[model samples]
Target: MANPDHEGDVGPQVAQREQRLSGLPQQVLYGVAYYAEYQPYDRLERDLDLMAAAELTVIRVGESVWSTWEPEDGRFELEWLHPVLDGAHARGIKVILGTPTYAMPPWLVRKYPEVTAERKTGVRIPYGHRQDGDYSNAAFRHYADRITRKVAGRYAPHPAVIGFQVDNEPGMELFHNRAAFQGFVDRLRHTYDDDPQRLNREWGLVYWSHRIARWDELWPPDGNTVPSYDLAWRRYQSQLTTDFIAAQAEIVRELARPDQFVTTCMALKRPAFDPRELNRSLDIAAVNPYYPMQDALTMPEPPPDAPQLEWETHSGVWAIHYQADLARAALRQPFLVTETNALSIGASHGNFPAFDGQWRQAAWALVARGARMIEYWHWHSIHYGHEQFWLGVLNHDGEPGRAYAEVQRIAAEFKQAGAAVVGLEPTADVALLYSRESKWAMEFHPPLATAAGAADRSSYERIFSRFYEGLFTAGVQTEILFAQDFDGTEHPVLIVPGLYVADDALLDRLAAYAHDGGHLVLSFRGGYADHEARPRTTKQPGRLFEAVGATYDEYTNLTAPVRCSGDFTGAATAWADALQPTTAETLAYYEHPHLGRWPAITTHEHGKGRVTYVGTLPDRELAVGLARWLRPNPDVFADRPKTVTVTSGRAPEGGLVRFVANWSWEQARLALPVAMTDVLNGTDLAFGEELHLGAWDVRVLLERPRKKDDEEGRPLA
Candidate 1:
């Protein structure tokens, strides 16, 4: 197959980056998942033509049709994929070939019934859908390896195949059969040095007559009521996913060439395991950031007194930005947007498609945060399947529409300034510590609920979002750091929201961070439990109580909204802690009828740094106040409107590249901090001059080159 001519405009930087192995794209990688097996050869040919016209540079295929690749048992008919691969290469598109292990062939499942995952009750999950196989089963691994190696060996040397997706969103299910449970027990025994006493003690298994006498007596987290045990089970399940993906990655590395990369996309919202841990084994990080814009609207209402969000809740690309930032941190490098809604449709609700320029805006949001590639969920809407209605770039008629046109516009933008965008590296001084362990603990037993007995399911997420949006509104770029990854030396200010589960070591680390001159912020119910979600055998906030200089003995689930008195005044809701400060200064207190004089917020100085403890969820203004207090002197776009967000990074050409985005419905006007050139429009902007931004619009500005003296670290003239 002869390579087709370049269809769209190609930038100089994009042309220069063609020889690179692994890094940010020279130009953006416009890709889609193409299912040639589902279409006739003639239709497939026409689709490739249209793909080239749309300036698509990459295509992911072969991952969806394992049954087509190998119909009979051990009968690998791999020749059918050759045409697709050749066609992609001929169209000047690289291929991210997938290991067909996510879904099992019917023959393999029929021969090995244990390959399917079993529920807690031992009922095997029926094998009609994808991701149904047991990740830890030895039999499953054997077949997974065989089929993966068969595909890898055949395509490892293919010129068009640039990388391999080890598995499709590897950790979406948990296998709870006999083998998996035995593996968990073995891991626990190994962790506790084969001492059942230590295991029972650490896990607090003596509660409710749940003590384990022997290692074998320990059960999988099926119906266990113990939060510690359930947390351990979830972590173990994550380990299984990591090991499963690693196994496939190792296989690919052994067969593929050095230039060929390996990665697995994450369907992140409810990941079966920690994605950060799993990405360590892969070459690059990728996430399917399904920004829940419409999904958020359909969500159940919160408690009557709970702080409700406005239309700005999920209107923008912060969901994408947040996930991309996390993915970049996980890989410690630029990552990829493996999948996003081409038309914003889902399985149940048919969401409205991208309106006008929203698609380009969302795409640029990913690029601004260090996404090397962005691919739509699929090329076209499937004719038959559960996701048939989840529309793609093309409608069911397979014709280019509004989304396709938007993508073309994005391709042209990349051709113009892809080099500048690709060269920039995102920087953030504010970091939010995130813990999956804490999330799991909250799931087991949330700290707050509604007066009518409705579970405040959004407690953890709400608190985190409150702080995140606070930082965003304060014009601070933020990075999400996991406990294992953060040592507190990277960011000057760190905020941890609702850290319900933590180890003494982590608590000590937080204290050390404050002692070492880092500003620390802790929210309500933080440090209340050990790493396993067991109540720490100490005071609330546990070992870090000294660092925080405050201890909470009593808390309340707020039935009505309350306001704060003292230093900061704002509405508080959901929960409040009766904090007694020993060496800390009270920043705020509850002004309620009965709760008056109770400390709502406190701050303590430790060594060269300080720690601030918030006892309840503060309203937006108060959250921003806390942020402003933590980051005094106003370096970033301070005092900016809550609807505006600023993300700044070092541009490829030397100076800073700032992305100013307005996610609100009303027009926002902000003064430029410094004179700069708008890269998006090639217009020069003056310092301190107010610039207007229409709703949902963004401006990418490159800071003007500094003076020669400034370059030498001299004072500006």
Candidate 2:
């Protein structure tokens, strides 16, 4: 029966809306995954109201709706979906309809055994869990394409439809096998388009392994760690996945008569797969920051001073400064905080962990950092997974639990502050390229000693963790850019901390950036090798070191608390390397007891460029010193707002609001330069107004009115 509410799915434009995929409105988008199975129309409808009450502009319906969208092969079901889309639209929320393909129904997988790829041990598992489905399977790919095309073609012109989110988090379960490896090997043979010698040059094969002969001889390497041939092939496979999703999304756009934006949501912390790759493929790349949630119950202890996420699986950003820093840097477009927890995790004591005022501050902290879209991972707390995966922003009863109230209040206050700090980009003086390859390749494995120490679990991880903490305490705006990501003209101060393996081509770009009067910093293993992690194109310390006038004499892993007698912020009792500079100046000497007279820090000049190198990871105090030494007090402010100042991007809308957030439960008087109207309370501010910000209160200076526009007797331009 045609749904009475949807009005027979209306216009050609209405049909096009289903195919459309644009970002939500100007205000900060607060969203929750509108799970089809768990939430019926009424609940989905209510949550949609709460979502808007919280100022959410986008509603993401899960692809698990496949059973409803295309119940059986070749049959389409729009009766249930039409109302959901129509309901969200009626409430002024954009709908991001997911393509029904993440988890294939058991019926399809069972019927086509060819769908499940074999493991290295030759055991083929059926499509069972959420992460199942073989991307390489023709049948799987075909059906996914067909269903997605139908959704796109049918709904592309709908006004309420803003974007088409194709598939939910693909490539979850990976195949590290010879067959998948060989598939790519065959692909590589076809690379250079039939010139065999070029492959030898790149692969460095003296005698091409007999295991690799014709394209058919290839097999996807069946191992957790990629064998050489498979490493390059994995990139190809990643490309294939990108192309597959892109093709599906494109078809929907084409057939539906494109109107809005389109993309997919991604798990940012995936080890092998790159978020950059995901970002590259999508229009508005959404991220799941489940950093503290998955393992929150396992977190060691409450920090004496601060509150951290529960179980931080990927420790670096989850716990450290890189957490928000990456969000500001990764994508140029407005980003989304697609996941968080209102209730934290369930404790071993048989109760759900609750959020305090601190959790509320942290959520705002994400907003201050430029999260255009924020959603608690799940709406209702559940009794599953040992209470480990804390996805709920509300309790099971859907009542105003502790976190629920906090999220509601903050979102409500922000709603009154229209487009205040929504679209702001990350502006930073310090550039720390957070390389995917560095995080994945240099993190840890057998043979290679991590950050330092023989028996240490993961030295590099430890160093990265400590470095991020140090940088945060130092209070500098830092960005994570990859060596591959550095555009020719980068920021003024570029700091490359650990196992850097940029190819010569990339090194030349870095040199040019340095040559263009920018400052560069290197420490420990800088310019160590090429992409393959081999001896590198130009040898130890690579070619750029010479340009920076530095040479790496040795790389030694020492435990921290590095002690030096000189005037250092704090001693570096341990370090990872002892570098020597040629025709350069030594900033800090490695005179520590164990360091034994090697250079731990140095500075040099090449062309118009300046380079600084740190041989060891120092304490936070010294890191502050180094940060000061890089760009110094110029970025420092005289008139301070609240400790938490928010800069946003939604400029077309009036006023950029900076929330001087004072969360210590203490009153704060903050000095301001520009006068602003409080979007939340509608209070007006005068220049140099001292804010009597109450404890746990956010005194937001709504829109900083422009002097030029004010002088012209018009609304600030």
Candidate 3:
């Protein structure tokens, strides 16, 4: 939806109209986020007849009011959302709309206070919250391109709108203003071409003296203490938030309508987010997963010193399927949850809604990970200002309670699993990878520490969520690659945890994906630094040290847990790596006596693949015994109960589905590992029978026949 030549590429005729979801409607779209300008009275025909008696199809609407769509500047009230999009297209819902430009209007911050935002260099950022200005200010992109072309030219031919969200969660504030630090010193004078000594020997900048001979003696990133100048000022503030959401998806694809569509909701812990270069200028991928509901979605988790939730939700249930496998790994297809947990999300002493069948077990675990749409994040409840108790789904007396009868039984089980689970596709044995420039060079040099010792800047999500919760507690099924979309013959078990800022062409493509047979793993501070966060002096895991047969210039940081013995036992917290194997084959060691002379895990082989490595940070029963020895084939509801989990995918005729759930409150059971069919109950079971489930249940099923030459229900890229 955005090829206006900002040159960040998305062309191919706008990627073939964003692979057609054009006016959506295949199913799985249950909804909310209907503001009706935060209704205090006059219920827009009782919120579109309780969103068509709760079998809602969609809603979204006016992204958090830019002062009720410009109450004063250029004075345009634009028919107050034309009776909420003509009463949500008279019942059969739909809508979406949204471009109120991340709430700025206090009279455009009292008439352009130099478009606010600074957070340090001059310290501005005063105006009341909501993305406090400076979206690369040129008078804030001329009033955010005149209210995003007057709200996409006043709701582009609204036959129940269809799509457009533009900006409501865009890289929240990395704008150290003064035109975002002179546009990061004119993008470092066109990325060092104006060579300030080749950006002083590629950012080593001769250390403390901070070299730089010109290019306006480059400085500002708030007193930067250089980690390759904070990973090139966090890759130029995530390329000014992917050039302000690809210039608002090229101003809503010049008034939308090639069947609408255009997105931007990703609040996936935004530190100047990237979302694979902002979903290459939007046309799909939307996020905001938000987790932690009741017993924090149980399942023997809640330990590593519980009491979490310090914002941007997510706590367990393998972090809600790792935020729906990171919103289906961004542009790797099927997405859109937009906002989640419609009730009790943040502040009001952080309430914790969802219990009776946990909103159908987190909407079938975000539709078994690929998620076509869930919506939430509202629909009544705002009785006044800063999210008054953030609870919605018709609360604060708007009526229909129990989170609107558990989102109307998950919108009648997504309308009886319509279109066999809309856009399924999710299936992965293990791939993981994910970097975001090694999470912005481990948030500028944090090699794990916190336990009060400081500097744990979530050390790359604590070493990639302990190997993605040990491949979701060894029921394995991951898929989140990134180093420019890695392949290794379509991931025959990749892993690669804290790949600390790699380069040498991604360590020669993970040593040629382990000399071509795959199964590469490697963990702890991988290939220790290269792509400008420097450090690779060519020894310690650098440049895949002989395909990781192992080497380590000593490492430490474990304030407690240490154990570890033979074939991968538990214990090995924080950080470690002292391994000195040579042609590798140690598979676990350190019971600690001078860290048992090295090895805490190792392996080799290399040509026709097999690398392994690890060297510490396992714990979680050594990441579920190294994800059940790197996925030793099982998962077809792998003997259930541990508060059951399952997952699976494919479905839209090519059939397979699965989902399962259970998340404990007791009654669990399992058995049937094949002959299926319940898809929200059209019953019929067989193959080994049983199944059951109950409390916080979920189910779904499908399976029998429909394989259509299944390459495991294709779609992984």
Candidate 4:
């Protein structure tokens, strides 16, 4: 039975119209996930009208509904999606079709019981929710390939389709199936050359009488006390997820048009796997930033007389900036926020919805940091679903609210200042090193509370975030560099935090970096273990001890805040270590009765540069002070107030776009670096003039727009 509305086929007129629409390049795209199948009302056209009114240029659909796409095995129902594409295209909106592999259909699962991922307890997870399918399962891969090809083939020729999201948050579930265990064994055999002795020796398996005699003698990593095997298991899981997404991307590429792209939404916060590896096969990096905006990155309170003092307060820009910067660093390019909040309700406990103008501030902050697109998680709230309470811009009643008003205002600004917001690259002189190896290693052997006297639960991300927050508060532009991506020659200042999993190669690189006139700041737990999480056999503090000129043979985890006073005065928490400086100078010491005179912070000069090793998790005040001491303000803004953060990028026109954002609730009056026009409001200002900003306000300034023929008009590589 052929559908009559198509008139034999989607004619050339529709194709030509879509091509014309595609010819006009947009500075940035904005929209939401349009789930027509899940909507209780039959008003998709009306919803499209609302989206058009809000200047939404894109809509993502058909990602999480596999049963609806194919009700039965080998029978696909793709016709239902035609209207969605047609409706969005009719309103000048492009669509991104998704491969429905994240969710599985009951018929397929009933036929292939092994397709589901098994929990670490060897119990197969029932398929009531998403991400239950096993990535390593052959049957799951077969169906994933079939369904991906079918959807991609059907939509590849559709002119309205702009891209394809391969899968929704892959690696969110950790699979411990039989296949994964065998895969782990194969990996171990390949790494150790089938030598059980080498594996046992490297992993220190002789302890606890856990030595393996043969390859088969090795069991799953469940309940394993050895860190090497545990680290290997995590690496294998990451590989599985990477391979799964790569397979679908390959399939989509084969069927997608040249203009179309293939990518996946990366969940960096979930900590299930590394997003860097998963993004290898993607076109552009897309991150989901549903951070606890109100409380994640704590900042000091404003003065009593500050503007909006009675209003609520939130953290600095570090939390979202860290995530987005890492996503951009993963791809080394401008990225997209595929999913952020509109109303921000649901399963997240104690989450406060956005205050008026807060949504606009957050959106513009992302754009200021090289994000080319910002799409809300959804358009309208679903009437019935597991996430029914996750409200959108439009509630279940389908009425626009304060969130929609904010989106509309932001859309107007984005349309007006297209060149200022787009094609700009975020650059930084400082880089923070992050790695999944360290995160997994720390999770396996967290700092014991008995040593600290307090039960400290700070994870690797939390500690890293604190350091980043320090730098952010200091108004230093920063970028995140993964361990694999770190290049010693690129960044002038490098900050390494709690790098629990260390190796000689990385330590050597850091030493060379410091010797070559680069500043290095390292925290506790750094250079303490190898890549496999085994303690280094050398003197305590591991391979880089010579560069740091310090050795900490003993450590303690604090049960309460321990006072530290000297050049640096503050309280330490979570963990502290006893430091014996070799050629280093002590900057601070513990003020405790028994632990007095022990170095709490040390600094060493190597070759032409410097290295600072913090022996304790310093408080926020000291953390901020350290960041400021490392990288002082540039000469252009040496006297700029600390309350205001300034980020600069090359404008599409041959000039710079400066984003001056006031992160505090109080008004910030800062001197302008140059005479410029505020692009956001078209106000011209003189150099050295004082500029005042209200609480949570952002100003985009353009520095003398250049002509199109100017050589510098081109973007920076």
Candidate 5:
């Protein structure tokens, strides 16, 4: 490989990243999941060639091959890896190597009892199953460190070795081992070692009263059923789980690219660990979401809103929740669709099923929202075809199937048009304040009200879904961000969704944004706490409430049918803020199912600025209408234009790239910014006019200038 200096052209390092955007190319690195179960070294080499020829430039090797790679334990096996990586690089494909963590060998889990996890029922779990490493045990880290440093340290400098995934899907399920449970207790003990009584006080449990005794008494409430106590314990367990992953990540980060990107591919339905905790240590987020209907309810036919309903279950509703998590994920840092069934599942048990063009379009929808990459769930399974839904492009024969051809065609299209779509961060008008610790803390707390209650679905998910689906469908570029994710320069206005707490830094920054005439909107749930997991009754929003021109009163938690109207629209009311309108005037209020005393939404003045709060649940109409009224953009794409999508990305060269898509049924003219060369066609187009975009055709205008720091949004090049 030629050591190319990252001067002006496509930076090789950025280009070598382990992902490529589905509709864009700067993200072209692709992965063919190569597991030990199918160690087709011969076919593997040939496959690498196929990937390169198709311009799919990445390979993700499994982390758990203990039974084979380290079959003798403590012994290293580079025999199988060296050629696999070298062969890929020989064909110009980069590789993201796993650290043998996904599945532990039977002997390792069997022999070292500490390496295994514990179930909530006090049963000791074992191996043969995958993702079974115990994070609590020092021994697990010890062994993990050895494998990581040994593998990563050796391969970090290699041209072929692009990145390392610590453990594939680290906490896919709850740790059901007593040792793992005991380890969590040990962590709590270590965190509060100085005072046992203080622990009891903070936890509101008097040990002598049998509230808690030995550490073993502390258990998470995730037995596929819930009790009040279990809820608290579950939250605690989640925090501990988070620490374990971070601890492992810290160890890996120390040895791997101090500057290199690291990410754990999240399990679709079973990513047990909080993504927020992992965000601190990760560079890119991997989104592997599943769309399982909520329950027995079938979807209504041809719904008034939303796209065509291919699914008719709680799965569709769950998909909204899934998308919300991703939308608000670490300020929505472009994530990878790490796992989507390459094809539909066949009626049989494990056979690979075929996916339709709809599936492909569904995937692109995610790309349009925020994902940086689109990685299929899997490549091959020894169980043969029909063993599982078709997650692979090739069947057991390793031959290109329909899925393979779809991906290949997509890849080729991207090759011609992707460069212009790189580094485009979402232009967020709203900062849905989300925090990792908040989620962990809330989940860990005992259930509100009483025992045997309905499950507490994430409200963050609710707000995100409403805002994301509504705004995105309208084709408005809005960002979902954490209060601390990026500076206000990235945005002129910031919308804080129900994250009611803030650190001094965030508070001060909000103050700064207000002083700079920035418009800040705080959702009903905002300003409820400080940085620490403590109530913000101190000064009511603690210290920053004054800057936002409002003070927190009491949290009025309500149920469904909540609405906010300007002095009075007839929308039903849920929860409201009994706020005293100080410098701020009331913009909207909760309507009468329960009225006047409820301030559903309010607006206030500050240093050349304004702050607004939505004190109730926002439906699509309110969200969009309010957004339009507040930070309205005059140059919005009128009449819901399709095929021609507008996007802006941060260029590796520190410039910007604006993308134009032609996802239309027929050739359509797209509004262009400059005398542009459609990177796809490699031809220049007339500037400042409507340029014809062909059906399903796309154009990328590169070398865009800096964005204007105004309401007009990122400027014309």
Candidate 6:
């Protein structure tokens, strides 16, 4: 087995070099996952021909079956994929070859039983599932490296192969194997500078008589009760995942061509993942964003009390944009949608495919938010597997269906638009701060409770999503900023919610940002704790008290909604802070007998700017009101109907590209604010003319360059 840190005789330094792919193709790439091997019969030629007819440009292949790639240890079967690649090349379709490392072969697992991952210290997870091994184990790494080199070496030179997906959705589980635990301990030792006392003090180990006198005194995270310890464990697990992907990417890069890229599919909500850290090592970021279809995509969405579906897919249309924005934020560049919905997407019982025209709507939405490629999860539905019911473009009978027709229309549109809309730089009026550390900490010590009174582990996401949804509802575009990457002046407004695990430097920076004329909107639990998940001894909202002009020493969990009055109307739910404002002015107050004494929202002038503090989890009405107040400036698409949404971005050729959609069954019309050419229809429309939109339809319009006389302040005819 090779040393995990070493790269052959070249050592660690050379292996650590970053080899990211710089640019992608100028046009939007559209296709699906083509599994010729998984087909019931030999249909490689026919599949390629159909893909060509659909105007598909690329197909991802060979990312799932490991046993087929290597039936026995040290044995390789590399010729089976040749026909598929050759057929695709003949049809002018490109390919993204995948390394089958995520799925371990049965023979390898049987030969090396110790490589199996343990859910707990000694409880090995049962086999017959994907990603069930401790990939950090030396034995597993040896075989993984061998197979990756063989497959990539064989196909890297293929004419149709354009890139490589290193692993399929890496970081699904947190391994608790002996080697993994030892690595965690070693990480702690280095982090604390080999000082046991420092680790003890930082982790607050004196509580419950848990102080460690030596490094070895640390117990496995399985039985840990401390929040700080759990935070450290989660961070270390994410680091392990990043390391694994980085190593595999390094292997593929060595075998790949200069034109071929290397990346792994990212499921953003995976437990043991950090996208920003992981993407630093890859060429381009890729994500699988699956969303609920049908009425779930409709605007003026179901009421708050509506019965929600229990699934892994995102719930609302705003959530879909949220996922795409997050993917762009990963490396601050355009990314790929490796796998999204084709037909139905989940278990055998779950089958709700998109309504007519929804595929086009979703594809345009993703592109508007910076997607370079749009690929479905698969081309044809599988005949047998755990995902057999996860339907595709061509269903079980292998005939082109509704999904295929919709995808084909989208592909032709992408071809027509060409380089005009690809690689767009999305516009943002507000910057929202995102913290992975804070999310991990809140998962362990949640501040909110479910309706059943159970601790809500998703407390961070709930708070963040409310503000994001409010911005989307109020027609304010947002840019997501990671805490470490946030500077003072990214946008006019910076909204931070439930940032409970920030260090002193970050808190101070937020204060400075407000002082430097940035409108800072803060919510409950911001600046409450240090990076170690230790509560600050200073007043609640520790470092921002001066900038905010308000402080809270007490808070409560509400059993019911509390009405809010003053500027913002609606109710506050789940939690509230008893804010004591010294220099701040009250913006809203809670309509309660006892809680009414403290303001529900307040604002204070500090330096050149102001800070508005929200003391409770706001209902949707209040959230939209607050968003409107924060970004009061009106744009061309302001005051549109509830069913109509318009998102604009800077195109690659330095022109404004706007995506106007009516997310409803009723036709809608929007009066143009500027002269623009419809990219899809090739029609020019004058300013103030009403543009018609069909139900569930989206139109891409490019703003025309102003005439010299118009630029000199003369009115255009």
> What total of clashing residue pairs does each candidate reach?
0, 56, 1, 8, 47, 0
Model 3: residue 379 alpha-carbon error in angstroms: 20
Worst 10 residues of 6 by lDDT: 1-10
Q: How high is the CA lDDT of each candidate model? A: 0.76, 0.58, 0.80, 0.77, 0.54, 0.86
C-alpha RMSD for every candidate: 6.9, 7.7, 20.1, 8.1, 7.5, 4.9
Residue lDDT tens for model 5, 427-521:
44443445544443444431122223444444444554554544443445565444445355435566666564466677666667767777776
lDDT of 1 by residue, 1-717 (tens): 112222122365234223234533477687888887765334878888888888888988888777877898788889888888898889888888888888788888899898889876488998798888898999988878888899999998998988889889877777788999899888888888999999878877778788888877776666778877778788998999999998998998889877778888887665477867887767778888766442231111122332222312332345567777777767556778889868756654546665465677677778878787889988888878788877788888888888788888777777676668773568776778888778777767877675686776556777787787666555567877776665555567889998988887888888888888888899998888877777776887787888899897888988777988777767788889989999999999888777886789999999998999999988867876777676633553664665666787665566677777766556788887677788867999887788888866678887777676553233111
Judge candidate 5 at residue 171 and give its lDDT: 63
- Considering TM-score, which of the candidate structures 4 and 6 is the better prediction for this target? 6
**Model 2, TM vs. native:** 0.82
Models 1 onward score TM values of: 0.90, 0.82, 0.40, 0.90, 0.74, 0.95
Better of 2 and 4 by TM-score: 4
User: What digit string (tens of lDDT, one per residue) describes model 4 on residues 1-717?
Assistant: 111131111456335324423422457777888898888868988899999999988888999988988899999899899999999989889888888999999998899988888887478987788789997899899999999999999888987888888888778777888887898899889999989999989888889999989999997767778888878888888889889888898898888776777778887755457877887666777887765443322234333432221111223456667777888876666677888878765463433566565677778778877787788888988888688877777877899888888888888888888756785677675878887888887777776453535433346766787788777766677877778655464567888998888778888888888898888889988889988898888876788889899997898877677878767666777778888999999888888886675788899998888888988887777777777777734536557666566776665456677777766566778887567788877888876789888876678888765467755343321
Error of 2 at 578 (Å): 1.8
Model 2 C-alpha RMSD to native: 7.7
Q: Which 10-residue span in candidate 5 carries the lowest summed lDDT?
A: 293-302
In terms of lDDT, model 2 sits at 0.58
Clashes in predicted model 6: 0
The segments of candidate 6 whose C-alpha lies over 4 angstroms from its true place after superposition are 1-23, 303-309, 707-717
In candidate 3, list every pair of residues with a backbone clash. 316-319
